[model samples]
Target: MTQTAPVMRDPGEDGRFGDFGGRFVPEALIPACEELHDAFRDAWTDDAFREEFHHVLREFGGRPTPITYLARLSESLGVRVYAKREDLAHTGSHKINNVVGQTLLTRRMGKTRVIAETGAGQHGVATATAAARLGLDCTVYMGELDTQRQALNVFRMELLGAKVVPVTSGSRTLKDAVNEAMREWVTCVDDTHYCLGSVMGPHPFPWMVREFQSIIGHEASRQMAELGVGTPDVVVACVGGGSNAAGIFAGFADSTAELVGVEAAGGAAISGGQPGVLHGMKSMLLQSESGQIEEAESISAGLDYPGIGPEHAHLAAIGRARYVGMADEPVIEALQLLSSSEGIIPALESAHAVAWIAREAGREIPSGSTVLLNLSGRGDKDVAQVRDILKGRS
Candidate 1:
């Protein structure tokens, strides 16, 4: 196969990637957004700031998460399967990568408090951990339903010294939590920073978050070279707001590796959506023909959202990355398969990618090809839920 590098460019001066991604936020929040954008731009360029960020990552969040070669799974699938083990990071997921960067940025901006929204609660836990470590106040908004489903994570955040607010409005899921968090940030913009969990929000957020999370791909690429594995034939990661996917993709974006993003079938914006504006950005969203945002349903709270990050939308539009969806049953089966075969249980969100590989490895992906799957999180928090699901099935 011929190899060509993708055209890599930062979002234009308007914070756009092609026709996707822009500051579609309320006029009242524009100044705050601009301030954040400027601060991030300046901080990102400073060597001292970069050193400090990496220092925090190494000393606190556990940087350079290893890439595990799945020997048994590889033999079973007739392909070389590897997992970039973000689940091994502190806080049990890749969410900490962005949280660490944002927390430092908040302190630099003279903010005393940080507020965030979460779906599966991983980001909330991560943010809360950073806040506690930095001695900053933290608050997290979670959908009522998600808080119930991910009760352990909710408690974990509270234990980390964050106030977890249950948002009961709208669909009572990630989107609603985001709405409430944005409202709260608007009221307290003077002293509080909205630490968006994903790469979905307006402007510098998508850009800023991606930069922080790109450590995953950078480390993976370097590790691969050191191990003499070269680049994999494909790179795969699950996408909610596309932080992990975007992060890992960033490393191989300009390379020949095929980038694939797995989304929950019940909430796949790119596969079953149209262009619409939601949560302050223009991206493919699961919306009604009348333009109302539809409620996305999925067993994985982290992947249960109506829209994706704008960069993922742009990548799909430009054929730089392929987006696929997996239903809940296959994801559950994949979770079990990985647990039994490799002794590694992945988060339900990450299981989407594993499920795709389980179904398509030898058929769609050629035999003997190489595949890198971003094991985005551990399934410790999801064990009870999956156990109940499997018990019901039996």
Candidate 2:
């Protein structure tokens, strides 16, 4: 495969990446979105705000997560593989990175309360943790199915003093939870800032969330250099709303490394989707001929969404990154392989990347090349579901 450096561009002043992203929300929320955009732009340029945000990350959310070399797994695959250990972050996931940054942004906007939508519940837990620390009211909307599947996370959010509202609309999944959260934001925009969990949604959010989570890629690149390794041959991360993938991609967007985003086979929006609008952004979405969003199914709740971040759509369009899909069986197998071989248990969402490596090794990806995988979160929250899957398989 030819490796060429990609030119990375932030969204235009109108918050568009080519033809993918824009503010396609109700007029009532336009002013709120604009206010957030201005506030974030100003704060992002302020050194004090940057320092404070970095300070909070280091002191609270555990910044500078390590990159593990995964010797045995690499040996098994006949390739050098490194895992960016976002699982070691304080909240056991990369979700906390964006949450902490946005929590600070919420405070800067003088918002007294923050609301969010969650799928696997990691985002809700992170948002709740930040809100509790900052003394802000927090409410998390989660699909009823997700709340049940990730019950412990619901308890964790409540323990952090946040209300967890089970959303019973649509498919009872992430997209539905997002729908409810957007509605809640419309009614409570005055004092309640919607802390969107992923790098989706309207205008500034995709840009702002990427800026916050980009730390993962930045740190991974530095850590790899410290270990005497050059830039990776490829950087891989799973994409649902694409926050983690976008985060890691930001660091290497201008590099020669091939950026690969793995998606759930059952919900592979970019791989099997058409251009359409959903969640306030025009992105690649799994929709029917009539433009109705299709229900996405994936064993990983975090990847069970019909739409992807608009930036991902732009990248794919411009040939800056490659997107692929992995089914549940391989994801589960990859999860177990990492746990058994490297003694690292990865979140199912993260496992999709591993599954891709396994599927492509020595074929699509040549052996001995270096691969950097974003281990987005731990698998503790998925242990029960995986156990059931394993049981049924046996």
Candidate 3:
């Protein structure tokens, strides 16, 4: 499902993505980030590092997930809907792509522990799985609210030998969990690797995570070509921290394809958000005018983030990608539609993109237009919440 492409390597000097992706972290972590920067830069180009990355990706992490043509869904919607099935990846989401890469790099850096923050626990479980496979110590920080909502993922992480810590501060969700993870990384800088789940974060992280995840777009583009769909008319993905969107969009940045990023309307950073610093990067954030971070709410816990990845901010500013916001109701509708029509249950986070595509098909998308959507994760994590919503509706 994938093939090699000409890689675009950016130096990421001082980690600034057009004034959006700078390292605005505490002074205590500067040296750690610098060490990670140098280590990552060296290892990424090393032959041994490449070999190890490739080995784990193919042998253990399950690379080249399928590009499924959702014919029934397409017929119902009156457009060509193709899905790059990240949901079928190991650990049930696109998150494992970055985790496997980072876990290998962590081993190279002589780090013995891995740490991260999770909103819906997909990232947390992915990290935990990598840590368990590599025999490294793992710990994940999650908001108490999310811990309760996604308790099954907590149990999954525990099964994979990771200890989950609940963050109770602020809104008690992804943001607070990230705050706690950063604090942990600063304190345990020598022995720990912070496995960031998205493309948002200080300089090297945005650049590094994107490089790991760009595999999705790389293979997907090749698969599309093989399918005789030379160039898609549009590419759509839902954005929480923008990792999946960045991965898929990075592949078509130079193509004549139009890229669209979907955000949760309740937590719509692109539409009703401002540029500010949150969690060490300057990007579009839901913040107060006086510069305080605001809490975001969404039916989809994974997309309930206040700030987006810095690379996305740059892409938006440069006109490389258009950002769309879909409200909660539409997201639910899309989730139901895809589940019923295609029998493919998408994560609520990804349903935002489906909702956007549904709306676009109703108006803008011409009949028979080819649209590629990143089915970022499976909806197993969302069954309970979805059931609750449906029952309430009944």
- Cα error of candidate 3 at position 360, Å: 0.9
lDDT of 2 by residue, 250-311 (tens): 98888879999999998999989999998899999999989999988898988989999999
Model 3 local distance difference test score: 0.89
Candidate 2 is scored at a TM of: 0.98
What is candidate 3's lDDT per residue for 198-274, written digit by digit as tens?
99888799999988989999889999999999779899999989999989987887787788999988788878789
Per-residue CA lDDT of model 1 for 318-354, tens digit only, reads: 8999999889999998999999999999999999999
Query: Please, what is the whole-model Cα lDDT of each candidate in the order they appear?
Result: 0.92, 0.91, 0.89
lDDT of 1 at 212: 93
Clashing pairs in 1: none
Model 2 error, position 348 (Å): 0.6
lDDT of 3 at 393: 94
